[model samples]
Target: MTDDGFMGPPWQMDWTPKAQAVRDTLPEHVRKTVDAVRAELVTAKDPYFRGVDTDADLPDGMKVRPIQSSVPKGPRIFFFGHGHGWLRHTFVRRVEDPQIVVEEVFWQ
Candidate 1:
């Protein structure tokens, strides 16, 4: 348990091939931003930390929603600001492994 009394262990973060491809295209500075986000995400009790709950809460040009097409309750797609653009990604929590799997990534 953490100092905050959170029960579970920190989640490991993994990126899908498609997500890696998108990440590979990012400029070094933007990649650093993504890495910073990953650092926070890996230790978060909730994978959706810092993410808004509804589309209505999204900032202009940002997107956040549940991906229905995904299996086993589906992953969540969310966006966060990176420089002038938004970095969008989808993540699913795997309880068995205590990991957050990033399924896709796009910059817009």
Candidate 2:
């Protein structure tokens, strides 16, 4: 295993149709930020990299903190993005697949 105890390869990433649509509608700057975040997430060796439990408050500023659902098992559902500007994207990481699927994108 690697230093982080992660075995196998890094997680792949994909975006749902809805999430892609939302991303397409984002302003240039926000879209760039989202792209950067996606790049970082895909390179993560651990599935829970930088993730926080959903119950916890989000971090301040442009930092990205994945918010994991409280469910004890099954596919992981989480979101990460700019906590302050409300640019959030929800994702699902299935147990069977080494992929991070972006489910929804929202900004306000």
Candidate 3:
């Protein structure tokens, strides 16, 4: 198992068709930030992505939080999360097994 308690080499990240569609709608810079976050999930040893918050509505250890911004103005300038601006939201759900599934990415 990995350091984050996930099975295999590290965390595995994947996107669904719906998620892909949402991601595609984002601006280039915002998409790049989201991509970086996803890459961090696959490479980072921490399973919970440490800094991100848990999704309040979803039970069973699901986490949802906005991705950090690289720009000085912050994530608000490019994406939208929970109806905000240029925000990138990541969704991680832990299954019964030792796997961590990235269920969705919200880019609105």
Q: List TM-score per model, in order.
A: 0.58, 0.59, 0.45
Clashing pairs in 1: none
Per residue, candidate 2 scores C-alpha lDDT tens digits across 7-93 of 434667778888889889999987876776676556655545444543233233334444544633334333345342333443354
List CA RMSD, all candidates. 5.5, 5.3, 11.0
Candidate 1 per-residue C-alpha lDDT over 1-108 given as tens digits, one digit per residue, 9 for 90 to 100: 546554454676778888888888998877876676566556545555334543443344344445554442456665556234444444444445656777666665
Give the TM-score (vs. native) of candidate 1. 0.58
Clashes of each: 0, 0, 6
Q: What is the lDDT of residue 50 in candidate 2?
A: 41
Clashing pairs in 3: 78-86, 79-85, 79-86, 79-87, 80-86, 80-87
Task: State in Å the error of residue 22, model 1.
Answer: 1.3
Name the regions of candidate 1 deviating beyond 4 angstroms: 1-7, 48-73, 82-96
What are the lDDT scores of the predictions, listed in order?
A: 0.58, 0.55, 0.45
lDDT of 1 at 47: 54
Model 3 C-alpha lDDT per residue in residues 1-108, reported as the tens digit of each score = 556654543555556677678778888976766665555445544443344342332223223343454432222111223333332333353543433344455553
